[model samples]
Target: MTRILAAALSSALLLASASAETLKDTLPHISVTGEASEEALPDRAILHLDIVADRLTATEAVTENERKTRSLSDGLVRQGVPIDDIRVVGVTLQSVATEEAAPRGAHGKHVSRGFRARSELSVTVNSLDEAASLLSRAIDAGSNDLRGVEFVVSDERTRLERLRIAAVKDAEQRARNYVEAVGAKLGRIIEIDHQEAVSATEANGRTEPLASASGVAFLRLRPGVRRLTARVSATWALSR
Candidate 1:
């Protein structure tokens, strides 16, 4: 009985392998790579602000940082911005020397004069028209450190779907062109592999710094357009 079962399993494996080989031999397919891209004006802006302060004690430094952050958030809200859009991204505390440390001693030890605390704020502006005004308000409220703004598209998923359709059409067109050139006719599609879409933001311009009489400084930014790309690879059967 054992020998019979072993023989039956071996026969089944052989038959399966033979079937796979036959299928491969009968179906000849051609593979092609296709790509499509679309561009849309950025409808959103992400700005990073840092509230940094240094004090003799860590607690004092952190307190000052928090106070400034609160002011900034309140200012953003007053500007008709949504409360959910303003968030604290990160907080950091570091010991920093007020002046350059003296030359290394025999013990190889350095002294820090005070602790610097930094609170990072992230604000997403949905309305590009209000970006400049909001930025100025945040700075005036108490945001001491300013980082550049990033422009992005809000309706990215819709654009991506459109690109997918374009990509499939592009593949079909190319396949047809190839088959015609080779004196063959394109048959039904046997396989399709959709590649992940690649997207990038093209910052058309930078923000110019604005200084006010109250020692508030911020950048006036322009939300530029971004480009999105989709790629696909397809395999179709060929015939004479």
Candidate 2:
């Protein structure tokens, strides 16, 4: 009976030691987040325009849209816009007006066959000076629809890479400061988490239509600065 009791006590001691080790390994650590921002001039601008035509039948609508699109393309080519930069993004033919149902006492009304066809093209203009003129010419050439324009930098990948490195360094410095303040030492890095960066236009000016025959308005293309932000959360072990 004495030998059996000794063996049971030893097993219980070993189990307790293992559980303590596991708890120590799974302890939570401190995590800190840091952010960095940089601003630079945008290098490119994207213009979105649409050509639309309505007719009694789909065939007529499509035909008229094709003619208008061709004319717009020609005008862009004359303005030195490259063919590769121009892409047809969307094409659709849909009913402009739906048939309305009659009252309970009246018969159902016949639906009209009127249809409108639209062709949308995305154009990338490297030169800001020509943007207004190009738009005006396209409008004169029969492009009735004009969508808002968006500006962007072509070398965004390079800018983001630099910002990421700066953000990581900033996060490390912040962690060090926190550890020093607490009178503790920072140990090995346990984990790292990164958030998606955002870029946007902080300011913009109102646009006014220009009186030009080319359907192009005189635009004031002010290339504004784009802000790139990067955030990182770092977890570091703390030691006393």
Candidate 3:
């Protein structure tokens, strides 16, 4: 009975697909796909780093790492970052074994080398002005590894929505242009399929860039022009 039910569901899906394909192929329409992305300056930066301490014992390593983490957080606050924005994301204590650090046994086995304690930190900086200083302070305070600094637009959802709107408009315009070039008129839209659409709605709000206060250039890092793509395939009827 289970096998029979599965086969029936599969057959229904196949028939539905075939019906849709028949309409797509038989309809007198012009189909076009459009792609677009959003671009704007970054409004926020996230700094990721690890505060690591290596010692002969796990307790020593953990103690040192905790001290360094405190220092790191304090330094970031001093650099104008909000205390709440700094986060200790993860902690790890592990014993590492190295051929050179550990002694070789009779059967070529290795002994305990060292214990490393690491703390991961994620800091969100609202203003880019404090990013460099905060990063430098983290290193000075005992941050061992600099993972990466992510530049981001806080209105990411809205930006993606705009990209989808743009792509839809692009497809519509393309269909119109094609019909016009062929001496025909574009009629009603038959199908609108977003192939690789991001889950976003149309947004009307837009941000205006602030003008520079001075002619002298200050090194400001912004998330450069980014392409967020939304692909749309649209079919429209053509009238002669």
Better of 1 and 3 by lDDT: 1
* lDDT, residue 233, candidate 2: 83
lDDT of 3 by residue, 98-140 (tens): 6444355534446677899999999998877666556665776
TM-score of each: 0.76, 0.75, 0.65
TM accuracy, model 3: 0.65
Question: Which regions of candidate 1 are displaced past 4 Å?
Answer: 1-26, 98-109, 195-204, 209-219
lDDT of 2 by residue, 33-75 (tens): 8888888776667788999999999999999999989888888
Instruction: Give model 1's TM-score versus the native structure.
Output: 0.76
Clashes of each: 0, 7, 1
Sorted on TM-score, best first, the list reads 1, 2, 3
Write the candidate numbers in order of decreasing lDDT: 1, 2, 3
